[model samples]
Target: MLIRDLPEDVVMEILSRLPVESLMRFKCVNKAWYFLIRNPDFIAKHLFWATSEKRHRGLLLNREHEITRTPWVSLHSNETLEVSRYVDLLQFFPRDVGELVVFGPCNGILCLFGVPADRNGPRDGLVLWNPATRESKALPIIQRPAEMPTTFPFRFGFGLDPKTGDLKVIRILNLNFRRCQVEVYNLSTDSWRVINTSVNPIYRINSPRFPSYLNGVHYWLACERGGPDHWLMLSFDMSNEVFQEIALPSLTERPSFEAVAVINDSVALILAYNDLATRFYYICVMNESGEEKTWTLMFTIGPLLHFTRLIELRDDGFVLLRNKNGWLVLYDPITQEQRELPIYGDSFQVVSYTETLVMLNGSGECA
Candidate 1:
C-alpha cells in the first residue's frame, strides 16, 4: 500500500524510526508529512528513538585539518571511524566569524562560539548547530556578564532544562577566587539573562571536563583553593538554575582525572594515576541522590598501551586516545582492541555523538 494509505499513527511510527536525513527529505513528500515532521511532539519522539541503546552509534570527532590545519569536526562510525558527515565549521558563518569554541551536543544540538579573527571585521558570535540535520541558527548576542580579572579564559556550559524541555547555555565568569557571574541563554525565547545567586567560593568547571553535561546538569572537576589541592565537582542544574558542590572519594584527598564522561546517564570520571611506574586509567561512577555523594570504582584499564594521551572516555566500552604520533585511536574495553583513525592533530576533542531530529524546525539556515 502507498504510504498515504497507511494509518497516520502507523505512518508516524515508521517515519520516526527512520534516520534524520530520511525524515528531512520526507518533509517534501506531502503536506500531511511536512506538518507531521515539523511537529514538536514528533521531533521529541524521534529524538528519544534516536538515542536508544540498540541503535547504531556515531562519534563527533573535532580536530584540526591534517593538511591546511583549519579546524573541523566530522561524524564517523564509532567502530571504524568512517566519516559519514564532514562539517567545515567556519564555512557556515561569514568570512570573519573566525575560530569557534565548541560546546555541548546536549540532545544533538552542539553550540559554537565564533571567536573573531578580525575584531574590526565581524563581532564574536554564537551558532546553534545540529550536525545530523545540518541546520544552524545564529543567535543574537546579548550584553555578556562582566569579565573576571583573572587571566584564565571564561566558559560556556550547555544543557537541556529537564523541567521545561528548554535548551539553555550558561556563561560563567569567575569574579574572583570566590564568586562567579552566571549568565544564561534560553533557546526557546532566544534571550539572555544574568542569574542571581549566593553560590559561593567559585568552584569552576574546567575545560578538561567541559563535555560533562549529563542528565540536565553541567559538571566540571575542580580543585579547591589553597593547601595541597583537594578535589570536588561543580555542577549547575539547568532546570533549577542552581549550583551544587559534590565531594569526591577521599583517596589521599586527590583523584587524578583524565576526563569526565556520562555512561548510562550517570557521570563517570576517568582517573589516571601511576602505580609502581606503570600508568593506568580508572573509571569511577557517582551516586548523586544521597546526602553524601559516593563514588564507586567501576574498573581499571591497562597493560600499558602505547597511547601517549588520553582524549575521551565514551560511555560504551570505547576510549578515544592519542599516541606519540599525534593520531586518534578508539579502544574497546570489551574486545581489548584499538583502532587508529586517519586524521592527525594534537587537539584531543572527540565526543560520543547520536543523531537527533531536534532543531530541524525549518527556521534556521540549512547547513
Candidate 2:
C-alpha cells in the first residue's frame, strides 16, 4: 500500500507502537515525520503507549564490573549475561570525573546540573540527558546577581513549559543566611529570570521527597511560612514560573527519609523511618490536599536486618544492597525474595540503570 493511502489515524497508531528509541532515530526519515514526532500531542500519546505496554515487562538485571567473570547478568531468568552482548542498548562510563550529580530519572530522562570538576569556573551548569538514545542538551546558566549564602540548599527540576513551547529548568535555592530566591531557565531563550513568590517559605529538607516532573510543575517539600520547623509542600509551575504550596496529611512527626515514588501512575510518597531496633515504612498516595490516603504498611526490617544501602530499582520496587555471610544479596521487599548478586569491586557505586543496564565500579562478582 502507498504511504499516502493509509488513514492518518491508522498511520499514527503504527508509529506510536514503535519504541521511543526507534522513533527518535526515524525523525530523520522526512520533514513530516520530524514535525509529527515533535508535536506535543504525539509525545503524550507515545508515552501513554509505552507505559501501558510496560506494566508487565520482565525484569532484566545485570552484574556489572566483574574482573574474573562477565560484566552483566540478567535477573529475570536467574542467569548471568555478557555486557558486550548488548552494547547497542548499553553504554558504560568506565569512570565519571564530573560534578554534575544526578538525583532522579524523569520520563526516561535523567536530570543533571553541573558542578565544578575542580572548582575552576565562575558558574554552575545544568543539562538533561536521555541515556537510551545518548541524547543531551546543556541548559543555560541561571545566575543570581549577588553571591548566594553559604547555607543555601538548592534543588533543580526540568520539564517542558507548554504555554511558551520552551523547556524550562526550575531551581529552588534556599538561603538561610539571607532570604531565598527562585530562578528559572528557559531553553528557547537561553536566559534566567528571578521570580517573586507570594509568601517566602523556609525550605524543608526532611519532608516528603519531590517528584521529577508532574503536570508541568516540579514539587518540593518546604518549611511553611509560619515557622522554621513547620513543613509544607511547594510546587513550581513551569509555564507561569509561579510558586504554590500543597497541603499533605497531618503527621505527629516528620519522617526521617523523604517518602517519594511513582505509584499507580501518580507520584506517591513512601514514608519510612527507622529506630536503632527496627525500620517502618508507610506507602501513602498523595492527593491535591497534600494529604495521603490509602495508607499501607509496606515493610518492617527488624533490628537484625543490617543493610548498607537501599536503591529503588526501575521495576517500582527497591533492592537492598546488603551483606549476608560475606556475600551481597539483592533483596526485594515487594516479593520478600533475595538473590546473591555478589559484589566484586573494591568501592562499588551504582551509576544508573536503563532497562536492565548495570555498570559496576571496579571488579564485582555475580552469581
On lDDT, the candidate that comes out on top is: 1
Q: Model 1, range 1-367, lDDT digits (tens) per residue?
A: 8888899899898888887778888888888888888788898788888787435456777776666555677888766778888776566567544355678778878887776556555555778888777888777763433453323566778889999988898877676666767788888888778898655554545664436788888987776556336667778899999988777777763446656667767788777776555567788998866577888988777644444667776666677777678878777766668888777895757766677778734463365
Clashes of each: 0, 14
What Cα-based lDDT does every candidate model obtain? 0.72, 0.50
Q: What TM-score do all the candidates reach, one by one?
A: 0.88, 0.66
Measured with C-alpha atoms, the lDDT of residue 269 in candidate 1 is: 78
Against the true structure, candidate 2 reaches a TM-score of 0.66
lDDT of 1 at 252: 69
Residue 245 of model 2, lDDT score: 66
Which digits, one per residue and each the tens of the lDDT, describe model 2 over residues 168-248?
A: 776766665246666777656667777886536445533223334566776665555447546555666787777776666
Q: What's the TM for model 1?
A: 0.88
Candidate that would win on TM-score:
1
Model 1: pairs clashing at backbone N, Cα or C within 3 Å: none
